[model samples]
Target: VLESFGSRGQDLSTEELWQKVLQEVTAEELRAPLHRLCALQAGWWLADRRLGSITSLFCLLRQAEDTGRARCSQGENKLLYLLKAWQVPAEEASLPLVQSAEDLKETLCTSAAFLQGLLELEAENFPTAFSLLKEAAGGFCSKRVLAQIYTCLGCCAQRMGKPQTALQHLKQALQVDFQCLPALSHAAAVYHELRETDAELQALALLYEALEKNPPGATSSNPRFLMQTELLVCTPVLASLLRDRHPSEVKYLLAQRCLQDGRVADAVEHYLDVLTLLQEGPQQQVPLVGSSALPRIPEVFLEAASALEQAGRHQDAITVCEEVISRTTDLIPRMLRVEEELELPECPSPGEGLAGLSQKKENLRCLAWRAAGYLHQGWARAVLGESKEAITQFSRCLGDLLRVQLCGSGVGLTENPLPEVEVLQKIRLLSLIGRGTQFLELGKHKEALLDFQHGLQISPGDPAAISYLVLALWKLDRKKEAAAHWLKISQSPPREDEQVGRSFPLYLMSCLQQAVFPHRESLSSRLQDYL
Candidate 1:
């Protein structure tokens, strides 16, 4: 009959099963299954609206406890504590069940301390909870119980502002049970507070790995079901912790790892997630991990644009660049308008003075990033054969790059006054190279030659710049000069693995091949040697 009852309970909804047990099962038949059900449900049954029936069930459990049944004492104490924690109203008589901890502890094992610790922890009394958990830890031989005790201690320490202590407790929890999700989650929070980003990510990664190992519905047993449900509940907590903290930086790092591991699709998804957050701001009402600073949004966008282009999503790459362009366009004009409106005295007001100077510096930095974005957009357009549009983009890029101001020697700044100067030079060289390539494709050999020469002045031994210079010279019928450049290129040392041809597109290489050696048979015979 007990086996049949268990089977029937499994087939019914939780509420329906409890109703059936209350209506048809006799008091003597209820004790075992009710205890089992409470353990399997993991306190979910407390959320149901049938409070009166639940209270009556607790009353029966208390009666069993009074009869000196140790198991019943432990179970009744747990249920009563859960009820109090969740603020569920119980009969006045049942209140004594929670206060009967001394009697229960005398009968049961050290779990009585664990139960009291959990109750105090939930009630936000950290010191008492920590002491009780510490006392309980030595008495448990079960890894699961020890893990829970340590995890609770970690939580208590964290709430009390002892991050180092919290981390130690969480580490001990993992030492006991490496797959403890609560321990991992708390460790992640502690790591974030300590500004140890790599550790935080490692903890989060292990947690997700553990969740994947035990997927939902992998088993029909009560313990497995409860664990699966707990995993589901904890998943969102991970996401929330990430979003509340440096989400953009975390996603950016993850994207780089994915790219290194040859997971291009995953990298693109992570990059896009970073862009979306920066573009839309964080979702409303999500709790932050700590006092997180804004991420480097523009730099992240530039990287995502480059990654998209590498993955052959040219149009998407162009769209991300356009976002940078739009932001800069809106920002620069507003900043200029504000600067004009704020009249400066010999000594500016403290608050406004610092804010105005900071804003000006940020505007300059944005201009540099905006120019780079345009350069990337031009390259993307050129790859798609839109030479006219690509040239226009490159022209705009050059204009923005030239507008950036270099810090003067007398500025009194301790940091490198012209931090953006290096960025400007690199973008200028790339802009010249891109525009020159477009000119070469359009048969404007003299214009292409001039552009290539200018880029060479910035980077003397850059292979792409030299190769294009050779192509331009050959196109303009300067055969002698072209041969001289080719000889110089042949004598140059091989580029290091990391520095080789990253900025040079393969299509440009093909174009250079055709222009340098017009005859098909000559190109085929020399292609392998040149490459």
Candidate 2:
């Protein structure tokens, strides 16, 4: 009955209705379609008016979970029917059942069981989750689902602190599906944590090599692995990894990382390379095409501006910031379009809803992420000594953030982000430190002190920061108090990997050593003076 809603009548198709529901496009927009679907379902009495609400709808879906827990049964097809009824999207896909058949609508044995285990594992019901998924190991199913089962088992074992068990599961998972991205990622992480450094690097390299290929297929063999590697490693540490990779977006990264590593000349070359690429590409278009549209500013001009700004060209910096901001309208849209296209889930149908769940406000989340990029970019500008310009950038980003909130999604633009409050606090602390440094550099000693004090309050006793505070106090001529602060810095020794900062403590000790034992210096020099 639901499938009859094409060009024939007011009847709506099940898949289309499901797609729309999964999207959670505001119900107001769904009014007409809702009226029709409701009439048809009501006529058939499958509408389940009692499950009008999302949470209640979830309870109805829980039957699928129950079937998995019961080791698979007749209720499997009923679950798919419920999924259609709920109108979930295919790509933001419903949980796969334990693949009793190629057509999931017929049975939910294989993927269904894995889905149950995944949820249970997440909830820390390790043993139970493990038991549920392992049921399909010997059963007929896709190697992909089988790979997931092994990975889940590995993670569960790792959480239980059973190293051997975890490794065993990882080996099994990899054997089942060598290209399983999640399995590889988790296996690498676990290997690193367990001190299997060689294995860890090997796994990391495997993922990187796979990502470099940009695999051509509906699945891309593991999109998360590719996207996440860029997010996790490429932007942070594995900077050398970018050398052999795509030279387009890579130049910006090289410039940024070079700045991070204090290699100014390397940064200059790469930034120049980016300019060369941009100059040769179409520079006049509204939405610049391809990798050349990066930075949304003329690379030559901006790179020159960056070089000048870093060399204390405040006015020249402002000129660059202004020009880039002006030209950004055309460039930013291009870059943003690229990002949006990347975000689009597999060949999205004209009106399909694309969230893990239909009603989760995922569109709002995606928008928020774009706005966050602006907010972070503003902060980057502020740190590079573009004071007034940074404020404007920050203001613009904050405004965009506010716009996201007003648009009314399930979440709001918060100082604290979802699922990770600790991380937000750390970011806020870093912001405080940045502000403190700005104040210090600009000769606002009192303001700098306040910012430092607040940063200390947020993250008490961090030696790097505490050392900076002590230096600030000493420079401000509070030697006695500052010396005491230095003592606190000395008590916590540097980690083995970071041996450079031990000098600050040593400097303080030398001063104190001289004061405490003024007569002792003569022992080492006794040959000349004592004779």
Candidate 3:
């Protein structure tokens, strides 16, 4: 009958089932299956989120402590062990049942202290939790439990704002149980806070490797106990673990950090790994949490493109840009209009439903990302010396930028464009410069001159624009104007923040037909000397 009860569905409450077991099973028979049944029921309650039922069951177990203490059967010990491991609270009553041996008594005391530490941790009483956990660590317990105690102590120290102390406790956790992924995660976070980039990367790499080998939710060898995942899901640390330590998220962080620190090849590799992981698994949305959140998928693709471009894999960069374009183009609106009276909200409005206002905001985001895709593709094509193709791509980028219409006659966008509009201005400047460079490649000096002059209007004294403008004026035989601009470039104190390298004009010259701009190097030298 007890074996049959295992298959019972949730239609019958665990408490009611317990009463039925007591009525049908004799005391001798009950003792055999009692702990097993309780463990099973506790899992069911946890799964259903009926934490109250779990607490009630824990109370019942504490009530039986007096009767079970003298016997100290293996059944009772296993039950107590699992209950504590699951973080099911036993009221501050009699000590949990264990064999009467001195070693067992020490273990029992440790169990009591561990539970109390967890209770204090839950209550956000860090000092008390730390003290209790420290005390618990001195007694005999399973290595898993010892690791958990150290982890809790580390968490307490972290909460108390002692990161160095927290790391020590966390290191002890891993020392006890090398498989303690949570300890590694906390250590990584500490390293990040300390601005130790290499240490943080090392920790993240270890965490990712560990998670891949023994992925979360894997079946445990000890079936009698709940899976570690089942217990962890209920805790606040688990929330942080899921938010900050997910495998794909970890890869993305690795890629982002690599990119920031100028590890272009590594960044591309990590970003590609993240993209592949996302494809094989469910797409992970960027969490809205600040700083630590993963970037949206489109943003990741754009970043990957940047990395690829830096690595001189211009064709691969174009391929990822096309991926972004294909994915987001259908979602973008053909036209996006904003009102002058109503300021554009940077975030979604609570009152505005997703189907209405929020969806509109989403569409705008898609448009901007798609435009970015075009911009990157254009730059890649220009770099590869496909000037005509590059001009077409830049024109497409400009077309997407022009879709945004500011609808109002009065004090309009001219007075103060939105921040998004300001970003669009920068993109527009790049597009003009790129297309102007392409025109120069085709020897259309007049058209190229107009583009460079217009680009200078948008951003005056732009080094790249000024350099190209000098080239265009010389090509049109306006040597006086050309010499004057050449002096401007020489006289202008070198801008450390110049977007274009001093050799950019020389690079542009190499990309064009050498015959059309014959003796360009000699002409440049003569002009510099004449100036």
Candidate 4:
């Protein structure tokens, strides 16, 4: 019975062993067997986050004590003491029964100190908690418990404003038990407070890996009190830790870091993982820390497409753009007027107050989202040398942008323009430049000239627009005007060579390959000498 219930219990299913305990273990056998049973069950329950089950077991052990049939063993007593200490403040609960044996006295004293330290930690008494944990640290305990002790020590140090010392203790916790995740989480927080973006990213990446390695529900065979994560650390202090974020959110953060650091390929892979997780739908079981950290789903798709474009995966970029387009296209209204948006009903009328305002805002977002999709898809097609198809996409983008009309006297477009107006105007400029370049590619110089001049009116003195406009004039035999325009751009002091290289926009790059500009050097070089 001891072998089945105690030593080899983990090999059997929890339910199978539990059933055996119910059927075969007798009243006379209950004392020693009950200690083993509570010890084993406490570990499983704590690890599984089934704290209610542990409470029931605690009550059952208490009943055995009342009957004088069970002398709770030292390990069981320590487990109960820790669990009781973790509760929020009330009148102090009775301490677990201590054995009278001389050798066990020191061990029980150390365990008492650990429990006191936890209570002090919970009450935000950092100095007291730090002192008690230090006293407990010198005594013998299981490595996992020692890891928890170190983690608490780290937490106390952080509260005491000794972040570097806190980090040292957190590192020690990980060394004691490499799977100690609370230490990793606290370290990440410390790194964040220090403004160590790269270190924080590394720490968050490690924490994420540890979490994925042991999904919370996976029952482990070693059922020694698996310290509940919440119990092991203070909630309010390390509340901003990335551990609270869903794994997908963490991936999104990591991807943003990689992209910022110029690791485009790595960013692309991480973004793909995020998109896959999102497509599987929200994981209701895992609490998302906050949705504020994530971009909206369509925005994330657009970011991924941009990253893919930067990585030179033009076809993949186009496909992602298509995904955004297909999803949001139906949501966009056929036309949007700024006047209707501004005049949303102030008083509640059947479907008309906040709901009406929200629907209008959503429609505006959908319009912007679909227009962005066409812009990206058109740019990708231009990159792939598909001039006619690219022109079609660019025209479609312009058609969407043109639907947003500025109407009504109090629109305040000049002083406080609506978001949709800003988005529409920006996209309109890009779409015009894009289609104009495509027009240049097909030798339609007059049409290309009109598009470039119109884009210049929207964003006057835009370097790319000026450059394309010059090219269009040069193509149309207006040499003196083209040279004058080129000279105006050259008068601005040159930026860094890398900046100059990138200053030429993506849409205009296709214009460089046009048959009209066939020369020994690139268009920028041709423009330099054209005067």
Clashes of each: 0, 16, 0, 0
* lDDT score, candidate 4: 0.67
| CA lDDT, every model vs. true structure | 0.60, 0.45, 0.68, 0.67
TM-score of 4: 0.58
Which sections of candidate 3 miss by over 4 Å?
1-166, 192-196, 219-238, 241-244, 283-293, 339-357, 406-422, 477-528
Tens digits of per-residue lDDT for model 2 on 180-215?
Answer: 665666676587677665576566556545644543
Q: Candidate 4 residues 493-531, lDDT tens each? A: 753432232232222222222212233246567666764
The TM-scores of all predictions, comma-separated, are: 0.48, 0.34, 0.62, 0.58
Candidate 4 least-lDDT 10 residues: 506-515
Tens digits of lDDT, candidate 1, 179-205: 566687678778878877678668766
Report how far off residue 368 is in candidate 2 (Å). 10
Q: Give the CA lDDT, 0 to 100, for residue 497 in model 3.
A: 45
Q: Residue 402 in model 3: shift from native, Å?
A: 0.7
Error of 1 at 276 (Å): 4.1
Q: Highest TM-score among the candidates is held by which one? A: 3
- The clash tally of candidate 3 reads 0
Error at 144, model 3, angstroms: 4.8
Q: How far off is residue 410 in model 2, in Å?
A: 22
Q: Against the true structure, whose lDDT is highest? A: 3
Our tally of clashes for model 1 stands at: 0
TM-score leaderboard ranking: 3, 4, 1, 2
Work out candidate 3's RMSD over C-alphas: 10.4
